[model samples]
Target chain A: MLEELTIQQKIKYLQDTLYVISGKWKLLILMSMYGGTCRFRELQRSVEGITTRVLSKELKELEVNKLIERKIDNTYPVLITYQLTPYSFSLKPMVDEMITWGAQHRKELSKP
Target chain B: MLEELTIQQKIKYLQDTLYVISGKWKLLILMSMYGGTCRFRELQRSVEGITTRVLSKELKELEVNKLIERKIDNTYPVLITYQLTPYSFSLKPMVDEMITWGAQHRKELSKP
Candidate 1:
């Protein structure tokens, strides 16, 4: 199916998925959430160096895209959890490829 | 190997490969070059809407990262050709996964 598309058509089709996961934080956020539902604070800590503001912003974007779902706990101390939607799980193979390719790239770049 | 890496290490490692390919036009440029060696002018035209300045900039960056190589023909017009490096071929599976996932995402989005 992929081979059928011209370069022009392929680029146009792929841009949507890339837009959903292009940022420095979105993939990292998704990777962190693969462990299942994580509280807002858990995500903040797991994705190191993300500011609370940026984390919230990325979360909102992911939720808007339906890649993730947000659940707010109605408990004594309110809590919120973020989890990857089943739809987002479709990205597993892409993430796996990135991991493999990324490892190779790091090794290649490390050569002096 | 990927499963062994902690999420922290994974993100840190993946960023390098992502850095090389994350822009709006870099992947498009690379996709265009999948046809084999192409001159600067050919690429400029193949990747629709990429201005000459941006094409030059992205081409230089791809060359710098060793994903693509540039060769000067030194012909009457002094042609320059760009080709993907063997190392960059490691990204083929990654690109395939993106094509598949990207197609899926587009289909899902088009649904009412």
Candidate 2:
């Protein structure tokens, strides 16, 4: 499929994808939610090293992109949670490839 | 495979990959080389938008990462060309996934 496209087209496709998932934190945030729905604090803890402010910002960006959905509950104490939208599942293959490549890269770099 | 790892481990793997390919230009530079070997000037033209200094820097980084090799022909005018290494082929699967997802993403966003 990629071979069919001109190099310019190929680069444009890649640019589109990167524009959505470019930052260091977006993929990490989405990866954490893969387990299940998560509260804001839970996500902050799960992602590790993300400050509350930064996590809040990344979550909003993901929401804007439609990759994740935010749900609010009107209980005595209102509850908020986030989960992956079906649309986001489209990213699974790419994310899997990244994880596999990343792990392999680590091993390659560690070789003496 | 991803399920077997803890979330932290997964994020770590991702971080490792992002650390290397984080910026916009690395993948673009690699993609340009897919056609065949190219000289510095040729690559500058192929990648578009990248300045000479930036392209030179990116090529050096790619060389250091072993994704590309620089061949210098010691002739009247030193013919320098760049080509992908076998190890770089490891990235094909991931790059393909990105292109597929990216193109799909553009279609997804254009929906009215």
Candidate 3:
């Protein structure tokens, strides 16, 4: 499929994808939520090194992109949680490939 | 494989990959080389909108990462060309997945 794309189209497609997922924290935040729905504090804890403010912004962006859903439970003490949407699964192949490549890269770099 | 990883390890792996490929221009420069080896001027032209200075920097970084080789032919006019290293092909699976997801993302965003 990539072979079928002209260079211009390929670049545009790559740009679109990167715009949604390229960031220090977006993918990490999403990875954290993969286990189950997570409240804001839980997410902050799970995605270590993420500040509360940064996590809030990343979650909002993910929600706007439809990659995640923010659910609110209106109890005596309101509870809000974030979870991956079905659409987020679209990233699984790419993410898997990245992990495979990354692990290999680490090994390659460690060669004596 | 990803499921087996603790969250910390997963995040580290992801970060390792992103450090190499996450950027506005690195992948674009790489995509241009997929056709074949190219001289600096040719690459700058093919990767539209890239300045000579930026392209030079990107090429040097790619060489440092061992993703590309910069060969200088000490002929009459010094024929310098950049080509992808075998290690770079390891990125093919990830790049293909990105292109696939990227095209789908463009379509998704165009919904009425």
Candidate 4:
């Protein structure tokens, strides 16, 4: 049997998962991937405000976590694209809820 | 009118929201509250092994974020309890999804 984590260890494990997806642009990248697989430049355009550096970093982190898969296409010059893994797609509902919640909260903020 | 945040600003704003809820124990606290308003001791028990210090700190932070409300019951001695605010309750679906997702992912982890 796999060892059971202590409460502290379980909490730490949860925290680590949060940390992996904790960046500003990570969810936006996630949201973007919902449309289709995206080339590096396509993601930049889709998210529309992330800098190259932060996007690169967030993509690398997601890739490392196995939430995203990067595929290289060698048709002439190499083209690279990112797509959500099945694991990553599992988070779609959470991300959508966040977006919906954000919209509602934003509406409230506009109240006098 | 509040100025529209730049793309960089928008990303940062989204990230800040994530950071506020990103703690390991935060969702568990939210989950426990679903049962009912939780006395401090009750929360400690429901969560099953969070340090008193960390619980106190997390409670304070949740209060600061306006996601939870703390009430002091003055029945002879003082009793403190935490309850989810409407805003916090709005997160119920998201939290539920996380728990469900975690369970599914855990099952996958156990597969050879």
The number of the candidate with the highest lDDT is 2
Ranking by DockQ: 2, 3, 1, 4
**Lowest lDDT 10-mer window, candidate 4 chain B?**
B1-10
Clashing pairs in 3: none
Clashing pairs in 2: none
Looking at model 2 chain A, report the run of 10 residues with the lowest lDDT sum: A1-10
DockQ of each model against the real complex?
A: 0.66, 0.73, 0.68, 0.19
Candidate 2: regions farther than 4 A off = B1-3
* Every prediction: chain A TM-score: 0.90, 0.91, 0.95, 0.77
Task: TM-score each candidate.
Answer: 0.89, 0.89, 0.90, 0.63
lDDT of 2 by residue, B11-79 (tens): 888887887777889999998898888999999988879999999988888887789999999998889
Error (Å) of candidate 4 at residue B78 is 4.3
Error of 3 at A73 (Å): 2.2
Model 1 lDDT per residue over A3-80, tens place:
798776677766766788887889989988989999988989888899999999999999887899999889878877
Better of 2 and 4 by DockQ: 2
Write the residue-wise lDDT of candidate 4 on B3-60 in tens digits: 3535444444555556667656776786668667889888999887799999999999
Q: What is the C-alpha lDDT of each candidate?
A: 0.84, 0.88, 0.87, 0.71
Which residue pairs come into collision in candidate 4?
A: none
Alpha carbon deviation, residue A90, candidate 2 (Å): 1.3
**Candidate 3 local lDDT, B13-107, one digit each (tens):** 88889888877889999988989899998998888788989889888888877899999899998899999999899898898898889999877
lDDT (10s digit) by residue, model 2, range A26-105: 99889888888999999888776889999998888888888999999999699999999999999989988999998888
